[model samples]
Target: MSAIPVKSKIDRDQLLKISPFKEVIKPTVPHKHADYFELILLEQGGGYHVIDDQRYEVLPPTVYFMKPGQTHCWDFSRIPKGYVILFREELLTRECLDVAYNLPVNITLNDVETLPGLTRQFCDDYRAGASPAILKAYLQLIVLKTGEEARTQSAEGRFTPLYYQFRSLVNEHFHQVRKIQAYANMLHIPAAQLNLICKSASGKTPSMLLNERIVLEAKTLLSNTDLSIKEITDVLDFSDPSNFVKFFKLYTSFTPKQYREMAIARLH
Candidate 1:
């Protein structure tokens, strides 16, 4: 717990920070951003990012939207070249209507050349003490562009609303319910239908998505708190710590103790 930096120190007001990925000096440890939105634009990189339950390859020309309370870890093979645009929802002047933006979604921004100019300008303006209005306009532009990209994926995009709802259900109930069928029942759909919905929208089955969400929450607790394994099992409503260990190892390849140690080492 002393090793993983908890997000208890975040300020109350909405905040925004922009920095080049290569210049960041902090450890890229597995952690949760509990109080703000994260917008990361990648131009060049190859690595793995575990966001929530699913794992994503850190491919170039991609933008990832990470909502508040999501846990993410980056293990880039090389120093990634990109911009990390972080902000709180309060920073924006207008409300964004993209339903998918409320959750985490990674969209491929194909025009790689275009992102650099905006990111560089934003950083420059930020460092030179530019007006809040100008800085926010840049943030809005990136969000709008990413939303357009999400919408361009045909019928797949049409399935986003349902997918988001299902995911939200999983996020909210994952601590207490681990069964995919249970989630389907809550969503008022058959288990098989729910699986198909997730597959169509995310290329991953509902079971995998649900498992990942549970694993993420477990990992967060293990890393950020001083609670013992038994206490964590109780928090997650597991039958016992042994059962919890088995489930954690199934997705993470590390038992709770091992995962916590490794994360603490990296963060330290």
Candidate 2:
């Protein structure tokens, strides 16, 4: 079975890089980035961007927040003009990481006037080989502005630190650790309180979130890789392949083989 390709758009030793979107736009395979987060601001564009299993229209003045490990591919109908910022987690503070994780997959910025200038300056600074501190400051400002605009669009409540920590833990251990109570224990909180925090922040129970992560992984593997059902089941840590099939059908209403066939059809 073929494995999904992993791409590292940034350099091995660099913590951050910024460039114009047009500079990097090209044919892309459905792929994952394992080591860095990507922030994109599209001043003008047209096409659909598929992230995991969701497809988003490439609207102008849009900001896309892609966390590490997401599987995505770009299909553009028009040349896109924008900036792409790639940064490792070391460049972010806990607060910035929280915002990054919690923001929508893509946000349409209401005001394009200031953000373009800010991104231009950021691109220029990176080209000049600015110090890490200076680069971090610029990244923080860009995140801050984009996040504020997202808040204005969604008007969602503030995401607490505990919620972000919960998400981080789940992302790191979803395959082996599936129990909500176990996550609560790791956070030193009662299961009941964990439920409250998750509900308030995301409108979903902790179990739902955990299961969603598992389902997303299953979909990514099924869609992008040549793994058979048995191999995929083992990779997901299911005790039996039948159980994995059942679980996947319960969430997605399609068996692994069926999903893979459908994905293959779409690619052609």
Candidate 3:
């Protein structure tokens, strides 16, 4: 079976959801969530989570995160007990939301850590219909803590505002703009300067980072939707389907069709 694109049904006005996994069952599939963020706390479960085509073994007392439109699914050896937290960008505004992205996609917390306590507190606040400000504050703490842990091993000065702005631009326009020079122009810096900034902050050239974003979107469309090769090519703004296949193969070592088949095989 093909992977699915699953959009969370939470209303626009309702910005967050907190649910106990044992009580409220939710969809588990090789799928993509359209326009929200997810924070998962697997307090007790052992399994593998396939997210963005990377396999992460689920260890209890750990938390996982998903950004908008990311493809993911869970394969559990047995039912797991955890808390699922869902929220939209509206809840954090721009500044607060950056903290969320500062974090890596997943984190495993130490058992003695107080993070689990914070997660439990979030559940209580969510159930009591706490004020939006209070709820956002708790989430901010959680998001900040997760980010702090992620940055622990990172050398200083690796994450700067320029790098983050570059990422934001790539996320929004990668399909339309593939040239690193254009990205640098938009950010009002020389192409050489942009490369150096990216190399210092992220250890990759700007072009490499830009192309990765394009490939990621192409993979998501190819794996999670029924769009044909030509349609995917045009959607990604390639000149033709052949170039799309070539680029896909260059990065993935598989043609679009082969990659889709592989993604489906993993799901089953």
Candidate 4:
């Protein structure tokens, strides 16, 4: 008798590009993927979602945004029926990608109680053979609504749309524009005004936010890719490799090599 070869669990891209939507496979136990983002709409299910080392209960009409590189897992023992849309970052429009990727927004969706009629209609459309493009648009709408609702329900209302926009622009262009003045120019606002808006909304200066974004990308590249430090420095538009090293150490307290070693160790 031949032994059965165990297949690895399906990832987000495979689930989206290969699998049929209506076919319900056996429930996936707690699992994580490193390369894909998942936007899930729970039609009917109760579970625990672990994202970025934080755990929350998942209930009906729940919408979640799981970014790449964040560790996420879910337990569906109690309720096992829902809709999961697995998509890659490239699936998003350029504008959506600019907003969603590399920003500091919280990506977990907790027990979302308010389900709008529009979302219900979207779900119905998804079930009724909607195109992937339509599904992506609906998912983006839900994410935007969730953020808006969160801001309205919060006491401080710290995350304004302009703040989000600035943050998105910073994430998308931090490597090229290392100064607040350049960003202000791009956004068509005075540098002082941009600084005031950032300070009012996030309590951080625009320069600080931009540096943080650049440092984050540097760290990601240092850990995930095989690019040399010089190449990385050039890609990030540093005047010199020494200057890039100085900037990286100033932000992270560790040299590039040290940081990369630590990150790889954690994975092992």
Candidate 5:
């Protein structure tokens, strides 16, 4: 018998054009993507989905979201039928959607059954040749539902605008600003206030979050590129190679060389 193929799909541009009707794939296996977000609704069958470091059982009427850069894999011992939507971050802008991006990163459909009819309606509408404007409207509605569910079910507080601003700044300047005060200065907020906002929203201080984001980027570079640590440090503007090494160790408990070795081992 032929081995089952691991099918991986990624779209980093506009929202993917997808069929709203249920899709069935048999004997599919595990896969991962580097950049893309996926929303999956399972209509039938049993399997498992691994997102990041967590695994979840797959059952009928199940829903899940997978963010970019996270690894996900699914079991296919039994064929599964479902509607899957793939979209990019740019598809929904914070300015356009009023901070929809602040919604929780993941959700389960079973917990939010109050909207199955609405979700089904959306699928039906899309399948029935809905216009792009209609589809976008439906998508925003879905996001709003998810956000409401998250707010009701999650113990974490909603992301404040200050926290959102800090996250955006980190995304834009993580390579350039290594200190919490630098970001606070850029935002014209006191360092202590920034820390308070980040802590209230994400349970981490601004400096910790900033360092963690930088470390994540550094790990990606170390794993995917052939650049030397010195070159990577220069690109990330760490002032010196030694400072970069110290920063990486402080956040990751691994020196640059050790982290690279571990990453190379995993690839092999």
Candidate 6:
């Protein structure tokens, strides 16, 4: 099968870019960027955006936060007017990543002008040769402002430090450390307390979260790379290829091969 295209719209030497959305939008295809996070702000919108195998409707005054290594594409029935902000992980803080991790893939805001206003300022500053520090500050403000509009104060506070720490550990070591107890050991908490903290913060058990992360990486490899099933199984640290197929099918209802076929078919 042919490989899915990996787009590098950002310059290799640059970590930040703020540009008009019109310049970037084109006919849709299943593609990914491995190096940067994308923040899309649309003043006018009519489209459907597919991200990581989930479809989201494009609504006006919309904000979409896409992390590194995510697969996405867009089909617009009506043209969208907006701005796109691209920044590398080095430009973000822990709080910014946490906010992005916790929020929905896209947010429809009631106060439309505020985010666009921020984007406009960001664009203006970027065009005026602003320093990296100033650009980083604006980027943080845009993220925090979106977080403010997308969730309540109590909701934001619901996620404790332990919860974030658990997620970080899982993201870093899900392939090697698969058990809730193992994660709890790393966090110095009882497995039951870890479960409770995860469930309380996100309504997902630790096991579910770990499995989800594994499934996500599996899907990424299946759809975006040319790895064989056995190779992917090894990359994911599964003991056997058949077991990996079963695990993927359990969460996604499609085996790795089937998912890859489906993902490749989207390009046509």
Off by over 4 Å in 6: 1-8, 11-15, 89-97, 152-157, 160-162, 165-200, 219-237, 252-268
lDDT of 2 at 100: 75
lDDT of candidate 2 vs native?
A: 0.85
Compare the candidates by TM-score and give the number of the best one: 2
lDDT (0-100) at residue 90 of candidate 3? 70
Q: Candidate 4 residues 1-268, lDDT tens each?
A: 0011122334544524322223332344333444555555565656566554345676655556655444455555465444555556555655555445423323334445444455666767866888877877776665555555444333432545556567767755666767778878878889998888888876788888888767766775665567888888888899999999999999989999998888778656
Instruction: Score every model by TM-score.
Output: 0.60, 0.85, 0.78, 0.58, 0.61, 0.73
lDDT of 1 by residue, 20-111 (tens): 77633233666666657777888777877767545688777888888766877777776677778878766653335243344346777767
Kindly report which residue stretches of model 4 are placed more than 4 angstroms away from their true locations once superposed: 1-38, 41-121, 127-141, 144-157
Candidate 6 TM-score versus the reference: 0.73
Worst 10 residues of 2 by lDDT: 152-161
Separate clash counts for every candidate: 0, 0, 0, 0, 0, 0
Worst 10 residues of 4 by lDDT: 1-10
lDDT of 3 by residue, 1-268 (tens): 2234566656767778888766323446667666678888877877788787788887777788887767887777756877888887677745556666666677877543577778888998889989988998887787777766666543434466678778878876777888888999999999999898889977889888888887887787776677999888888888999999999999989999999998789768
Ranking by lDDT, best first? 2, 6, 3, 1, 5, 4
Winner of 1 and 4 under TM-score: 1
Total clashes, candidate 2? 0
What does candidate 3 score on TM?
Answer: 0.78
* lDDT assessment of candidate 1: 0.72
**Candidate 5 on 1-64: residue-level lDDT in tens?**
0011223464334565444524444532334444455666666657666554345777666666
Q: Tell me how far the alpha carbon of residue 17 in candidate 6 is from the true structure, in angstroms, after superposition.
A: 2.3
Write model 6 residue lDDT over 39-130, tens digit each, in one string: 89988868688887777888888888887666788888788888999888677687876776666678888887888998999999999999
lDDT of 2 by residue, 40-74 (tens): 89988788898997779999989888887788988
* Clashing residue pairs in candidate 5 (N, C-alpha, C atoms within 3 angstroms): none
Overall lDDT per candidate, in order of appearance: 0.72, 0.85, 0.77, 0.61, 0.65, 0.82
Better TM-score candidate (3, 5): 3
